[model samples]
Target: MAVTSNKQGAAMQLCMALPENFRRQDFLAFHRRDADQLSEHVTEDSLLKGVVWQGQPACLSLFFTERNVSVTLDADTAWSADGQRTLEAWVGHMLGLTQPVAHFEQRFAADPVVGSLLQRQAGLRVPQSASAFEAVAWAIIGQQISVSVAIAVRRKLIQHASLLHASGLYCHPDAQTVAGMDEEQLKALGFSRSKAVALLGVARNEELVALLAQPVATAEQAEAVSSRLLAVKGIGPWTVSYALLRGFGWLDGSLHGDVAVRRNLQQLLQRPEKLSDKETAEWLRAFSPWRALMAAHLWAQQSSAGY
Candidate 1:
């Protein structure tokens, strides 16, 4: 990573090379789902978002070139070289640059179901959250609600709990911030009592927080994390799976319970109706260790079906 700075220590830019077959349009479209521009700002050519660095707010501006993505961090204070490397690593993780999509493609290119998606979507990868806290909290907030409503409620939560950066963007709150929030405060932001409790429960629990922060590098580790998360109140299979996918970039999460995944799968198979969650789970078993990637493909398939 080559680093460049123009504002002395207050700003720095690092360029990361994009892999061959990287799906730029799909990645940008995924980021565009933040319609309200609360946590992230996305344009046709670039993305601007905020992050918390060493207990301070910072802005990340990402500009894509033909071969590389340039990430520029702007902050009020200077950070050590190690701190800067940490931020660069976080940005790479969030952008899905570290995911092994190539290996997935190599393994599934001849399979049914998702094989065409591998060919069509090419280098599609899972975009992770800045932190595990954001992923789990988002999954809880989205439970039993439409995506649009969930996005709106998430914006509300960020507005209420996040810190404002010098660049006028709100950084998503960390676990400690959310844990410190009162249930009534979240309720006032349109979260149901149950969701408020659930979000707080995950955030406040020390064991859960530590587990969330753990590096999930293997299937066994991922499963252990899922088991622990499911034991928490207000978290279910769907929530645990979703959190694992978004937070840890664990690719095997079975999202058969997701309505859109089932509906899109029906369309993919030309079935008369969406499969039941059980049937969907059974069908997805063939794609073990890559089911979440299949889900992402299904989502992309659904998003482009209108045209």
Candidate 2:
């Protein structure tokens, strides 16, 4: 991946190539699903989001076209050459540009259920968050709640713990920021006491996030990450799977525990009722190494079906 950067005053401007299969519409649509729409902003052909950059609050903007993207970082100080490259790579990862899904399309073209989705939603990649901690926190917040409600709680948490960028966008709180808050504070923000404890536990666990951020290239590696996450109190299979998918762009995490996944599976299979989570897990095992992508297809199918 080639990157070019220019520092103009307080902003770092960058130009990076987009993958051929990159679907701008899908990317924007995926982010637009964020019910909160607080820290992240999405437009027809661009994205603007606040993130903790180099341990400081910053806002990154990306204007997308067919073949390439232009990025602007709003920060207090100009980034060094290395920082610029790191930021560029992070932006690429966050946009899912770093993930190649052609193999998935090729491998599943003959699959009856997913083949059609692959054709319909070609170029779809799991969009990642700014950090693993952010993804984990979202997973915790979203557990057993409606997306809108979870988003509202998340917005409140951001307002309580986050800093605003010059662009007036609030940066999602980093682990240190969230960890510093008392459990009662998070609970006051609508987090259940259990969730508050879990979030705080994960946030204070500095090494866990670092371990999860590493590239997961194999089943063994993914399992190791899962083991570490599961060992944490209040972290479960669904939470770990979601964090892996949305945080590390890991493609194989089984999402059978997801309600929407099971509901869509019931519809797709023409069943009278949604499959139990255990049944869904069994069915999803057939698509190992691509279950998460299959889950993505099911989610897209749900949206298209107006479910």
Candidate 3:
């Protein structure tokens, strides 16, 4: 087992939520529950460990495989409290795993047809993750980069986002802070023009502010609310879908266009021919909500293949 510590500091009261609609075992299974690669995260300061962000009141969500559940942010340090945290882990789990049709029929409701379809197919789903501010920030840092490289960039971005001490872990930057950052600063940090532009543009978008203003509940409304994010300048189908899975708690979204996903699917399908978008869509359709889980499973496989 790994020791646990918070980089930001001691926390306020943490209200952890794991929705009844979501299954913890199903969710962990999707991520493979692989501790070797995920251990550093037990300490909040590690690059590959937790997901940190600065919203109205600066929050952090860290994943500790040592404990089978993804823990809520311990917001203590300089960060104060809001009212209550909204996890919708159930919704996130819905979007993160791939399951059999029968299994999903039992778990997810039918009001959202696509989500239900996905649930029936995929066992789990990945949540959309962060709001636009955090999504674009992460997306920019991760663009055209390897996992290690992206993790390094995230470290720098987090450093730029706040005043770090104690253990050198910092909160993700606020939109205003990032908005004021110059392209030259980003360039000096090896950020590509496209990535810098996208990140900065996100920092300036008023819609990001609007999103921050809202209370994040779950993916119950993702099928409708996702469109608002998709309309953003830097956001696209993949980005929105990513957010829906991690952020909005989308249960059934898949990223067929993703390079990693495409490569992984190629290995999984082992078809006579290369996969087209249409064919990929068809092939992935069977996985539905579990497509995200399949994705995680495939990612772990691909990642281990190199070793």
- Global CA lDDT computed for model 2: 0.82
lDDT string, candidate 1, 1-307, tens digits: 4444344468777777777666666666666777788768888778888777656888889898877888888877766767657766777787777787888888989887667877988888887777888889889998999878888888898899769998788998888888889999999998999899888888888888888888798988988888888777888999998888888888888999999889988988899976999998988887777888778878878772110
Off by over 4 Å in 2: 34-36, 304-307
Write the number of the candidate with greater TM-score, choosing between 1 and 3.
Answer: 1
Every model's TM-score: 0.92, 0.93, 0.61
- Which scores greater on lDDT, model 2 or model 3? 2
Cα RMSD (Å) per model? 2.6, 2.2, 7.7
* Winner by TM-score: 2
TM-score of 1: 0.92
Q: In model 2, how many backbone clashes occur? A: 0
Q: Write the per-residue lDDT of candidate 3 for residues 136-226, one digit (tens) a residue.
A: 4665566556756766665566656554423343445667878889888877676777677767766677775566435344455554445
Q: Is candidate 1 or candidate 3 better by lDDT?
A: 1
Model 3 poorest ten-residue lDDT run: 38-47
Among these predicted structures, which one has the highest lDDT?
Answer: 2
Candidate 2 TM-score versus the reference: 0.93
Clashing pairs in 1: none
User: In candidate 1, residue 266 scores what lDDT?
Assistant: 93
